[model samples]
Target: MAAGLAVTLATMTMGACSGERSEFDTRNESFLNDASPDAPAPGPGCGHQCSLDGRSVINTCTGETVQTCAADLACGAGVCQPPCAAAAADKSSNGCDFYFQEPRFEYTTISQSCYAAYVVNTSMQPVEVSMELEGKPLDLSRALYRAEPGSAEMTPLVGPIPPGESAILFISDKSPDTPLTPLESAYLGCPEGVVPASYVGGTPWGTGYGVAFHLTTNAPVSLAAVFPFGGASSAYSSATLLLPVPTWAKQHMIVNAWEMFRDGFGPGAQIFAAEDDTEVTIVPSRPIQSGKGVTGAPARVPVTYHLDKGQLLQIAQNEELTGSLVSSTKPTAIVGGHACANVPTHVTTCDVLAQQIPALEQWGHEYVGVGYAPRMGGEDELMMYRIIAARDGTRLDYDPALPAGAPVTMSAGEHVSFPAGVGEAFVVRTQDADHPIYLAAYMPGHGAAGGIWTGSDGRGDPDFVNVVPAGQYMSSYSFYADPTFADTSLVLVRAKTNGEFKDVSLECAGTLTDWKPVGTRGDYEFTRVILSRNYRPGDSFDGGGTCQYGLQRTKSDGPFTATIWGTAYCVSYGYTGGMALRKLVEIPLDVPH
Candidate 1:
């Protein structure tokens, strides 16, 4: 995941040591007077050690302070500057006494081309045994073939440990059946040269954290794990991953997996799929920092494992034995827009509108403005407008009359409107590209002047009013009123794209006397809200006219726990701009407050 630079805290400014015998030496002198176990000389890679006021201060690789008092004081804020504890039953003595700390795991869904290779904190601590991938109910004693045609299982195998341990396991079709698919190995590919292998664990959750065998802190650590079997491969494989981190973690962490082959050939292959068979589990642990405090060590803790693959073949295989795919899955949604919108209705307030707009779901689709020939007055006629929907290098659908142009890719539910007279109103009757845009103009602005082009969904460009058309005075119109007037005739002109013009002339022949005000011509309008509490599956609401900020429900930290959700805004749209009005758009604050 991308992140801003982290500001490191200033190192504990080494204050002058108070000349008193440090805590460790002063208290242990009397016991040592009787002669017990002789303190072993610090190891070769041991960090800096100093005595501070009767305590042993050890500065680990990460600059963290570790204080050990001679069987008395507590380690406070990484330092041993304290009075010693006299009683033996005190938990304070046990607090920071551990000679070594375990590694921190940043649980993440398995990567597209990478299998689970947890970071092991080998520095300072003894790590002799490596981590292994274990499986549950469905025995993975041997590498299991994923139901996904040619994919093999990809699981982790732990090996002898040491400081700074990090490794990955490869399970191919030829390997014995284990729980996970070999999708990761297929993409990552086997190394060109010899690499050490290790033992595989067979626990269900073991697929992620895998079983880790701790090494003796005093011995030389080996770089590999014990793989029970070896073999060749007929097909490729990818690893499964967990969707998100554990609920308890505070910061948001993301796992990025890219393909790396023997020759560094091929572009990053398509890594995502929309089905359930490809779902992978992500296990979480503290972030791994090499040489840092024992945070990189693989943890042997219990974690929840729920099968959630999207690839259809894997889904079937998981279900054949694990029961229904739904039964084996967890109730968490993926992070992408489309994936977020697809989370089961039971778990979240899925954006029904976002689902309808492809652009909102993916970035590849864009809302691009095309050719725009400003009309001096009425030189241009027949303003052409069209919308094209494309995906995966293919035009799924498009407007037949729109000229060649760029596409206005927007979220599924996002709506854009062109000025009246830019072209005939094409209402978005449905999710079809051929559908005409919807238009709506209020009374007085009724008919052609009040005309609007919109979709059947009720979304459209602003209604055209006070059209100077051909021979009318300009002073009678408020450029702010009929803002589209300044839009001229063509804001966009292109072939095969969802492009539109900002300026255009409206087709209005009504006499001046017949004109009427479209409601109150003011920035302030009575803001009405529907479904403020319980909205139907696909329900939506919109606004237009002088209003810049449309009505929107307040967002919540989590789904369905909204104590209140309604129009909460600033002087401008969502509190950003500087515009203010005596009577601004407001909604019923009575959102069950």
Candidate 2:
């Protein structure tokens, strides 16, 4: 969940205006106006009447006072400012406030450009935005609308703008390909991260997407609103939205391999690949191949594309390898296209896949990790676990026995351990198994097991780790030289046949040192195996059917490796009895090439 958090992509800016004095809340509120009917006729020498904020005026002598008095004498003394004098003042000089309201659809032109309606309270007071559809909370978050080009910025309408000032509002239809989804609609409905915007009232709307802005402020600052005339969605591309970047914000160009190869290393590509933080300058090398059969020899190649960041044209040349050709052009983000090294000296490609439907909504990468547990019985059966965590901040603890319900809480710094009567169980013959089970003290979750020899079955210890032939009796125990130079095996002597019996391989090259077991059985209990060999981060081994995930050989003073003995089930059931011995193992991996 935290790993895939969404970030704000861009910001909007509102047009600038001069400030004017006003008497109002100056918060996110509006100014008010009132008129007196009992006022006497205009005093002598009064040519016209003007509102105190200086927006409209009425001519007293010319009889215009009777018609425009509503706007001229809203809330002050009859004499306030004379209308004739107010008209002489520049409209830009008068301060008017603007804020965003409903994003309702207005009329549209034949060209499909949209006109939208937005109400702003110029009354000099802040107002909370609320909406109800048929008396129910209206989820307008996914409401289809977009601001015209250059409408990406917003300014606060409460402070600083001169009184009687007017700002703009723009709205339209944009980003049709990526229609708003239910999840996004839900997110927008919450209003946790919504930013205010500003624009010129009555500004004409365009078709293509550019930047759209709103208004906001932590302190008092004068501002106005912008309501553009168009809001429409079209199949063809047009300049509907153009977002502006602030001087303090950081901008990045997401690039893909194909786009780099085909577009000839465009500005976005050069910036992503350039080293030393140096400016990029790319040029055309040779004509890039367009067909599937085309290939390039390893050498420095030149390419070109048109774009610039921070007012500078980006340019650079890249060294490419022959027979290792890749796509020329790619999207801003590629799902997966990287590779890592393997043991015995080899390479493997990894593809990042979408774990959920609708790839645009969810994306993730997968990597293999090894898991080792000695036995299962009593309370150990209910313990649920998963090798990988989900993007939703939840673990996929899978167990076959437990029913799915609320997540079971585990005590802090506590782990369940089997004291006696329980034995280690393992699924062999396969390397992939996912299931849920209940360990008496624990609940169920996701887990994987089994993938060794396809048809061969595996076994586990029913009573103890590495116990052999529980029913029959044996009389000898010994440690011999390893047959395999780098491998280790577990050997049992004078052991029982039916109770706990398993034939395990034991091989090592150096002195026996640092050996430990899980139970009181001493040498018979399940203990971790150690080997002396330096390993890199990603190094791994098949372990035949015996191990998986990341298996590493560590570097130590001696050549000998340690391992646990087998279980009685193995001697009776053979390989089908599963792994009789189990131990927690830590291996070092090799570095990626």
Cα-based TM-score, every candidate: 0.20, 0.16
Name the weakest run of 10 consecutive residues (lDDT summed) in model 1: 570-579
Which ranges in model 1 have alpha carbons more than 4 Å from their true place? 1-122, 130-159, 164-188, 192-593
Candidate 1 clash total?
125
**Candidate 2 off by > 4 Å:** 1-278, 281-593
Give the alpha carbon lDDT tens digit for every residue of 1-593 in model 2.
11111100011121111121131111210011111112233557644433323334455445354333344323222343333222112111011211122111111211212223222223333323322211233333332122221222234334332322223222332223445543332112111122222211211121111111232221111221111121111111111111111101111111111111211211111112111222222222223332122232212253332212111121111221111111212111111100100000111110010000001111111111111222221323322222111112222221111122323222211112211111222110111111111111111111101221111112221111111211111111111111111112232221112233233232221222223332222213222332211111111224422221111112221111221212111110000011111001111111111
Q: Give the lDDT of residue 174 in candidate 2.
A: 29
lDDT, candidate 2, residue 471?
12
Provide the lDDT at 238 for model 2.
Answer: 10
RMSD over all Cα atoms, model 1: 29.8
Model 2 residue 155 lDDT score: 41
